[model samples]
Target: MDIREYRESDWNQVWTIIEKVFRAGETYAFSPEISELEARNVWIEMPKKTYVAIADDDEILGTYYIKPNQPDLGSHVCNCGYIVSESARGKGVASRLCKHSQQVAVELGFRAMQYNLVVSTNEGAIRLWIKLGFEVVGILPNAYKSKSAGYVDALVMYKELKT
Candidate 1:
């Protein structure tokens, strides 16, 4: 897979992925009925930069967004959220996106990356993140009200990007 910066033209395709991922109520914390306008704000407008992972023909198979974890005092640390199409899962898209996000964070001068509310029940993501060197720094009990399991814990994972 090839990772590249997102272009304005990519929003439609990116939304296709985002809609499916979010509506599934599995990975992200977004409401299933999240409007496109809100999605645009969250996935594109808010992020410092967004990326799309594509195939040779340039079909967007996965995507991620990176931004500062907080403004002002906490700006040195960044955060990222990722989504891989269901059809594209188990094919290394998430891994590639995470790696690309870390590299992009470094390029943007971020000292570390943190995932603030990773659902503990999301085993695949938890495993992938741990494999990518993120440590579980904290856990918020009953933080995520999963549609499937209701009130599951959320894990806070962090990785210092600079050496």
Candidate 2:
């Protein structure tokens, strides 16, 4: 598999991956009913950069986007969101996308990375992020409206990329 910058041609595949995850409403904060146009804006246009993980056969296995965590003074801290095709889960697609995102973050001059709304029930992602050097900086009680778990807690994770 290989990782590379996202291209317009990747949108359909990328959206398919994200749409299912978003519709699940278990991990990300996006609305389950989020429209394609809205998703396109959020996943592609708004982020500083977006990337995809492609398989040997050129299938898009996963995708991620990196952008400023906040505006102005807080811009040095970047934020990212990732999604792996359900079929690719447990194959390290998400992990690879995250690792690649960090390298891209530093190359983009970001000093740190933050994930503002990681649902606590997403153990796999939490474990991977911790393994990759991020820490739980804070927790928001009943912040995520999970489809299966009702209102669940959300975690704020952070990592310093450059001293």
The whole-model lDDT of each prediction reads 0.93, 0.94
The residue-by-residue lDDT of candidate 1 on 1-163, one tens digit each, is: 7899999999999999999878878668999899999999999999999999999887999999999999999999999999997789999999999998998899999999999999999999999999999999999999988878988999999999873
Best by TM-score: 2
Among all windows of 10 consecutive residues in model 2, the one with the lowest summed lDDT is 92-101
Predict model 2's lDDT versus the native.
Answer: 0.94
- Residues 1-163 of candidate 2: C-alpha lDDT, one tens digit per residue: 9999999999999999999999998988889999999999999999999999999999999999999999999999999999999999999888889988988999999999999999999999999999999999999999999999999999999999963
lDDT of 2 at 51: 93
Off by over 4 Å in 2: none
TM-scores, one per candidate: 0.97, 0.98
Candidate 1 is scored at a TM of 0.97
Candidate 1 ranges with C-alpha deviation above 4 Å = none
